[model samples]
Target chain A: MEELSKKELVLKQAKLAINFGVGVIAFASIWVFQFTIFPDFFKPEPTIVEFIPDSTEPESVSYFELDSADIENGIHVPTGLIVDDGCQDVMVTCGACHSLDLVTQNRATRDGWKEIIVWMQETQKLWDLGEKEVVILDYLAKNYAPENTGRRKNIENIEWYNL
Target chain B: MSKKDSRRTFLSKSAIATLAAIVGSKVVFAENFPKELEPVGLQPDEVKVKIPGKSDQLKILNSKPLSAETPPHLLDDEVTPAHLMFVRNNGIPPEEVDVQKWTLTIDGESVVKPMTFGIKELMDNFDHYSYNLTIECGGNGRAEFNPPAKGNQWGLGGVACTKWTGVRLKDVLNKVGIKDDAVYIGYYGADTHLSGDPDKVVISRGVPIKKALEDETLIAWAMNDQAIPVMNGYPLRLVCGGWPASTSGKWLTRISVRDKEHDGPKMEGQSYRVPKFPVPPGTKVPDDQMKIIESMPVKSIITYPKTGAIIPKGGSFEVRGHAWAGDLKVKKMEISIDFGVTWKTCELKDPINRLAWQRWKINVKLPEFGYYEIWARATDEKGVAQPMVLPGWNPKGYLNNASHRIGVRQG
Candidate 1:
């Protein structure tokens, strides 16, 4: 290497100093972003609130009593199901997988209810009901038996164009 | 400058470069790795349950009942893969099936001699056949009902066409020697009811003797050249082509030939029956007036350029889909881009198997950037076309053959 003049040596040193300063600043900025800014920016958002209505009123009685008026007048109960003696058990057990509307909408006899329960337990992996099975069956059969509201009259006397 | 100074500078530069490289690698790694995906709409227990080889894109309708539907867009292939086929289970699928021990029993009034055969013996004795069959749930497209049906809400993905390998039902019935008085053929499966009641049948339904004897009907053991998936019925299942899948029982174990109409479970009342005449949606017809649901109507579905897709404003797009008619062959498929105002006939491809869905494709030209509804309608050999709206629905919401509409935005 050739010996540098004093002025040229000063200019070279100045350029080296400027480059080193830039490198340091860049590295420091990245460190600041990683440690100070990133955590706040990437914080998790709050979870969405589910829409299930809570109407369970604290009661001192051994079990929640059904209001006969609500059942007779066809009034919608707080759970969106007909209130009855075994409603609490049904809600806890059946509501785990499906909405209560699936239970209330269809009318079935005691045997039919038993058939459905058997089907559910065998195939759907519903836990054994133990003593609650009897109470649930009786409740469903008593309140939700099939009614004789006859079906609409069949279309009659139309000559078929094709079978 | 001295050689020593130059060497020292070089050493410092290399050290800095190595440090920078390590920092760069860490930053890149953080940005590129994918985050864990959580299952949507699943309970805690359901999150752990996994269907082996199943696509993650399938929408789970119910985890306990194991009801799922394939997204219509994902069904692009002519023959649906076993893993992608929609799963609709009435009961829990048996955890492990012993194929060796499984036996199929054929008995009832029609048989010359009641017979029982192990799966191996059955496969060995019967002549094997394979066909591409489309099995659609009767409740398919039930979600589209206005009032919403009581059962699982399924989109168009409730149906799938798969290559089913099995023995023909007619051949088996012939081997067993059906009597002249037999009027119906009832089916039973090994899957138990929910209550585990030994006496109760989860869902036992059958077909008229004439329909059961159809050449296309089969007792399938394999789907898509593989052992049938557990959810689809392993060991054996009845492949009742062109009818409600319920008639084709899964995990089939017994076939009962009857002298009169079989009154099996799910056969009575309005379980799978619909009104004889067109009735307004939500109307309940008397049991005597109801007729058992049979052959599905002609229908078409657009599989490509899924609904709500956005395409380039001036690009040419190809519209592709599949069409099928129950029993009858598909004669023509028409596509409409302007909400059924004007229609263009699509080129229909030859079906791989009889009664299988026919694929259709057409080149579409987008004049300008706007929203468009692509409608596909199929007409059967009998000249029956799909209705513009859902044909009159009964309480059960069956046989919805409205023209499939896929909305797309051109931008």
Candidate 2:
């Protein structure tokens, strides 16, 4: 008719430009396979941070910059308890339940650190350190005493079998 | 409305209402808080979840003085599954406990008539008896102590094998009589003392009144048939079967008896003693040259393709493990993959209880892989066996047993 309706409108504009170029290369290969293989489905989800009391924001005492070679080898003294002078009353009272590396790995004697702070104030519920129990038993009998570092080495000269 | 597009749409709607009020207040503070009000030396990081009948590959190490361990390939079963057992606490594990007002006294001077009972008159007047013992923890492999060991750096999951039950602590010391000049028995326990010190006695420990009148010493209150898990040692506890489970104490109530060696509070100096001879790893002996550490020796672990484990290069695998020994029995085991210059044996099994543990197996056959290891060892039926290293370090590194290994890999 008019050159076949202008060649069927140029073959319907070349099949809508090859189905919009294969739907833009299948939507750019599914966004490059979701940003290169599932990228944890586009990350960014962890947020939860509630606990906002203290009269709604008046508690800021964060601090942490201590690593001057871990406070000069007593290792990051936040409570490895060796900032000296009664390390803040043994870090607000015996690091509040276990680990100042269990009082810097045992060694005692100010009457054995006042008999282990009176056996942890008469059986481990440790309250009453009234009068700061002689400044935490004079900083745990002057920096954790007890040294006679001996007894341990024994496996010598192999060859024994019998089983 | 172009005032910079309404100020960039009110700054992205106040930054999405401050990120939905900070993630809706952290999901209502983790669904109404209470993990003991948080702030307590915050040491997190050791995860491995799954605790339904345990074996989520343990290794907890200290959840407030309560330690944990299991991964010698989830301790290949044969009992030991009160949630993969292994908790070891020295204090702080008693919160409620009223088990019919618990009791258990038994008095000192080796009794004569002292008694006390309760807990339903000590389980309706005695005679129960269960078995399958194997307690361990005489510093079970104190982290292969080379220059290590001071305490609890255990490995090979300290040790387990359960089925306890209860009754015969020599039929409650022959119905409260004993007294012939006792010669140790002690035992105590209620727990507390992580510094809440009810007069400090976190580890009483005793035994040796002829191994506390052994008839396979018990007194436990069940442990595989349940009831015994208030962090292990609920109402009563003592088992003492193949010794060294700190002479099986745990929350018991009392039981003195003494005459000589029952020093109590982890009995005197060098707690649980050791080094009656080979002293060199650090050397300081002289508490009558130390000794105390009761049983536990010819060990063996491997579990099953665990150390590094990769496999599939030439094939044929198998391996497995378990072993034990302390009141004798294990007999042989062996294995070694190329390290001890070649060895094999294995296939043991037997032991379902006569003081537990056994297991073994073997197969192997890689022949072209790369890394290897494997090891194992064991022995005992009194021919001892085990030590390839780590045999003597003591200052509380107690009995190690060595051998074990594992490694694997392949390509």
Candidate 3:
């Protein structure tokens, strides 16, 4: 058997101790660093607030309801765009939750428009249009009629190949 | 050192060397593993959901299945793999609920009564069975519009065929007694807080009475013979065969029978519409430029060749695809290898049901090495087939059914 020199023994001892120390420190630090830093890294950032309709107000307009001026323009205007036509108090109330563009863009008949406003008031909490219902009817009947030209353009003309 | 001590020293020395070797190899092994598997920065679910967005509206949901494609061979047998099935949701998916607590409400212009029944009541009162049906988004192939309209811009994977077991919608309506004036039956989803429209905070859509009375229209509780996953509208949902995604509301909770049509963005003005006139390509149509969207056109895609795969010379392979039509049956499917110069007819297998997609197959001999474009077109019995040219483009994009094409290379 070869006998080890004292210098060699000392060198071997120092090497083993240092390697063991490094391994222990590395393992411990890996766990500690991970435990300490991980939560923040994985945390979810703040999300943009999604729109929520008012649950409390029963008189608020349904988002789809179109006011009278929109009917006159033949465009379903958003609630915000309804001009302050002094004809009726209902336009002011209908303009609160939506823009006049919503109403103007739609092409519903007078009855259909009335039902929509009623649905908004009943289900969506839109406020009453007060006594302006007649004006809204006249506005919708005169201008917001559906265009006959656009109805026939659906799937009839497309070409289809064999199976 | 003693012999045992010497052995320990040797083992420890070798172990240290091995450790160093492992650490070095690990860096290389990390490269070998997919970047997804490594703990770079995100969790598994987060990474799974973050499919690079193709459109502005295609959100990365935290829970829905990541993809909608399955290997042809894996789909060889009955039952589409759950992961491969297409997902159609109007809004964020709802969490799972106890089936017993959930209820289906049937109300509106119906004469007999306003009634709400639990799932058990529905199952017991009506015949329960499974039928195969295909549900596709209204915007499934919308990305193909010639003018490049704005929508999800989904690829060919936005559809799925599945076996849904439940009661017929007509049976439930009959029990409630449909009024004479009922022209439409609107379906409302329980999934709440839809993002875009205020009136649409609760999205409700409907179908004509003719379709509502479809014997195949089912109030499905289970999908693929298992409880429908939460992402796919758990508890119960209405599946309207041959109709677009908007017609079949997910997380369905209410049924309202109406004398007149249900009017909403999803109904009167959106989801189903076409251009008022055939316009030039690449046009962004104004709102006034559109007409209402209706029946789906015929469309087919080559599911094989794996998109850019290189097949060996003299390789003989089978090409397969799926085709479906709205309100009519697919009569024939044709395959064109020479860019429509000459066409070969493919064999279309019998559909599992009238509503499901029919599988098509053709054998092709891969010619000399070059890039080949494989084209498939389907035609319905009504002679309506996929159009090569799309003339309609609208502000709210609708109805994009162009012939499906894929490119492959032969080495």
Name the top TM-score candidate: 1
Expressed as tens digits, the lDDT of each residue in B358-382 for candidate 2 is 8888888768857667777988887
State the C-alpha lDDT per candidate: 0.71, 0.68, 0.59
Against the true structure, what is model 1's DockQ? 0.01
lDDT of 3 by residue, B363-386 (tens): 888668786767788889888777
Q: If you assessed candidate 1 against the hidden native complex, which CAPRI class would it receive?
A: incorrect
Docking class of 2: incorrect
Judged by whole-model lDDT over C-alpha atoms, candidate 3 comes out at: 0.59
Q: Which ten residues in a row have the lowest lDDT in candidate 2 chain B?
A: B29-38
TM-score of chain A of each: 0.48, 0.26, 0.38
Considering only N, C-alpha and C atoms within 3 Å, which residue pairs clash in candidate 1?
A: A118-B194, A118-B195, A119-B194, A119-B195, A120-B194, A121-B194, A122-B194, A122-B195, A123-B194
What lDDT score is found at residue A133 in candidate 1? 76
Worst 10 residues of 3 chain B by lDDT: B34-43
Per-residue accuracy of model 1 over A1-163 as CA lDDT, tens digit each: 3456777898989999999999999999997888786665566774423222235732211133344553544533533456556665564456544545456555656876886788656554565676667778877888777654322212223222210
Q: Rank the candidates by DockQ, best first.
A: 2, 1, 3
Tell me how far the alpha carbon of residue B25 in candidate 2 is from the true structure, in angstroms, after superposition: 34
Tens digits of per-residue lDDT, candidate 3, A1-163, equal: 2455777888999999999999999999987898797856666884323224368733222222334554445322322223333222233333323323344434555665676677666554454555446656656555555444331222222222211
